[model samples]
Target: MSLQYFAGAACRALTARKDGPSLYEVCDPILRQPGSGGDPHLSKFYRTALGNPALRTLLRRAGLPELNDPARLNALRQALVLARDNPTPDWESVGGPIAELVDGITLQHPAPPRRTGAVAMPPAAEIDRVIRACGADLLGSYGRNGFIPTYAAFNLIGDPDIRGREVLMALQGLDARGYKNSTLMFNLARVFIARSPAAAVINPPWRGIAEPMWEPVQIRHRSAYYDAFFTEALLSYLETGLASSEQTGTARAAIAAMVDFCLETSREEVRGADGKSYHVVTALAPPPHPRFSRFFTQIKQDLGFGVYVPDCDTTACSFSAATQAGSNDPILDQPLVDFYAGYQVRAGGNEPRVTVPINDNIDYEGGVATWIDSMAGERPYGNDLDPTLNLDVLEVSFRNLTRWQILETEARLAFIRRIVGFQQRLVLSGAFADPRAHIYYLPELYCAYFGRCYHAFMALPPAARQAIDPGGAFELIRLRVLAYVEDELVGREMNPFDAALALIALGHLGGNEASFAPAVHCIVTAFGEGGRRHPYRAYEWNKMKTPTRILVGGPEVTSAFVLMGLALARRCR
Candidate 1:
């Protein structure tokens, strides 16, 4: 329940499902390990012995027949009879040959399998130390002067950031010539690292910043789609981390530049809501920089990169950033509020569609659609409801306080009503764990925002809660959220991906940490021993046209989440 280790990341995991690896398949690498990485009380592996693909593959390849039960799970009551032996071989004499075969033979499956040697899982305490150290190295070594990636691509052993869309290479002047710069990572990273315990060990990365960060110019929705909230994160960064530093004035100007980029580029449109039309910031504002003038503003016209109109995702985040940066402009009043508020799906109207690969959208009407234009227009996009963005809207609606409150009373209440309505839809439909109910973000990322919202909801006074919800609307569902996380712990602890999300959810929900010691040890020992975990696909090929799926995010951000979970675990201990 400690707010000190409350984990937050504006991290995104985007992908358009093109059918390659399931989330479980990506998790196959570590789950097959021989022991509970070191805890003896726990099982040697997360799942049962029959499911260890690598071991079975190894046995098959060595010309030894595997146990051929219907489930491949058998107990040898008499003895392990290897009939291939010329004569009866003693157990002691056969050890060397078996050890030699099993030591480092490569497995065919598991995508990029590791050539593991004699396994001695690291002790629990050692694993814990390694978890902290890995987090330390991730932040201190790379995060010290680097930008976090939007997609945490799990390229564990291959070349790092293989897509060439990284600011890290751009900063280092490496081979990444056409570096696809991110609009939000630097600011987001600053916020995450600063808030985490890692800040105590390393110097602030944005200490000397004085320039407005660039818009997400290189990234194309139709043209340069902008992200401004990571800028707000930067503003939060400068105000909290370096207010008295000499770079304060420069920092403000840099922040203003990005905020202005968001403001000036917003599409001012008259949208109808509450039976009236209001001029709101409809579209994401690209930077006014003339260098990118060739990029088209009328997004519907461009058929090349697929049409990405203004969405609740961008509008809500951009509006939140604007409010935080001290803007009292009228755009924050009716137009923007009503425009977004008008988009939430009406109750009982969400028809089932299987467009996204993650989950079924059954009875999701209260949720907000991804894009404003509902594909009826010339531009073909919309009808997809994203839980991640809904939570983002919910997060800003509360702004770390109890009960959703923003904008004028009438519009704000209307907005909060729909926001809460969609939240109910997500939980009741059982889609919250399905990649945050979409293909673009991980369940972990969704939990990160959900945790914040839950924390804020808990802050409400009892009277205030009763007045708002009337009948304790969220009380039963809150238990559901906690139970869902606890259910995950009951299953086999797979990889750091599951562990990270489970630990963070429990921490946010104020659950007892002692209940999930095995999973915690799994995370600690995985890092303590192998010292390797690539970014598993948090999201997939969100592009309009692509044969193969494209994943994002790097190991550095992956390590940060692991570290965040470890921090909370340490506090509980």
Candidate 2:
């Protein structure tokens, strides 16, 4: 975790000298020979040396030149090259130079914008076209699996603060046509209740499934975390919406039944450090068969019973058996904490709050291994799961709770602060600095930045906002975002979904309305006229060629994000 090593490694990874191989290549040969583990030092470098905060402290102590100074940066790079080649280098001797290098490589803040331009609204006609296209897509894509439909429904129905009548009607039509029973359907019902209780009361969808939805069903373990939160959200919404005496008693009973079922079925008991037993909810209950019993036992032994389920397909199971436990990974635990925090807020009662077990040995090295192992399809790993995407869902839940005033002010502020910290660390880590490392994740990243993180920051109080971004980090982020959109999105053939995401991010970043006109025009043109099916493509990144076409998900997903982009554009306007 030493900052010096982190800075050196980062600089080495980022730079390629004209004279020879990169400093990274010199120090860690395994990066060049990807499949081989010839050097132990190489294996440990990524986890231990990169992104260490201690390096920053050492740089400040050494009184180095500012990060933007070209001379200082060049000198540090040369020193790094020397250090990489020295077999028995004295780190103490190189410490001063390394500090200077570290200082030179840190992310520099951009100057504040000279003009914070007035909001430039997108044209109403264009907005109508995109909205109509999205609505049609949602109708065509109903009953599909994955959260895309749920997301589409929610976006179309609009947020509590932003209402779109046409979108709402599209969703109501789906309901009228009798959408099948699924976790997402229930989740959407909750959203409806939260946004408009009167409408929800009159809605056939909510009324139809209001009682029977509480029954237990086997949900895939991966989806369980979100399903749980949505269920709780529904209950919370029901409590508030049914405040009037006419429907209070029956609604409260149904809500009570649902909560009890969730607790009883999902809870698992584990002993704490104090030798006291506590119950925590598992995302999904393992099947009661001898074949899976042994696997379940292993998950319970290593990371406790409920943090994350280790059971996967046969290939993954074999990998899990050979590798160390992935449950100890912090990324896994953080999301669990996020879900529980929201659940606690939603399920306000005398029930004791669940605390995550702290494993002091969980370090950067372990996280990297876990991530590598998971990505290689050898073991269950949560680190590879983008927190930005996961947090987007949680952020939506949190925002709705806060808006409804269900979450206490202090708790809401605390959650907002945590989210702000997460976003700051993500940006500073330079995770997206490498195009190859983040190409596939660009759309999700954009959605998270604009749809969740930016909104959360804006919701913070003045003092809190200043504390998080005192040095114009937002301005720098905005600049980086603009560069990415122009380089990766504009004039290049990309999926409508990704294009829509870039548009939303641009709107949120406060780019000129006219600049987005071309993109908007592209979307409308691709949407075409009449009932022709908008082509659906899966999301994948091609290193050899830039994507000029959409991948993955149907028109439903594309239209949902398009509508979302338009909604955001309206706000910015």
lDDT of every predicted structure (CA atoms): 0.40, 0.34
RMSD of each: 20.1, 21.8
Candidate 1 Cα outliers beyond 4 Å, as residue runs: 1-148, 151-303, 318-337, 347-361, 374-378, 400-415, 429-439, 442-445, 515-550, 563-573
| lDDT per residue (tens digit) for residues 27-86 in model 2 | 233222222322223223322322134332221122222423666545544433333344
> Residue 572 error for model 2, in Å?
4.0
Global local distance difference test of model 1: 0.40
lDDT of 1 at 432: 70
Worst 10 residues of 1 by lDDT: 175-184
Clashing pairs in model 2, backbone N/Cα/C closer than 3 A: 3-54, 3-55, 4-55, 6-49, 493-548, 537-551, 537-552, 538-551, 538-552
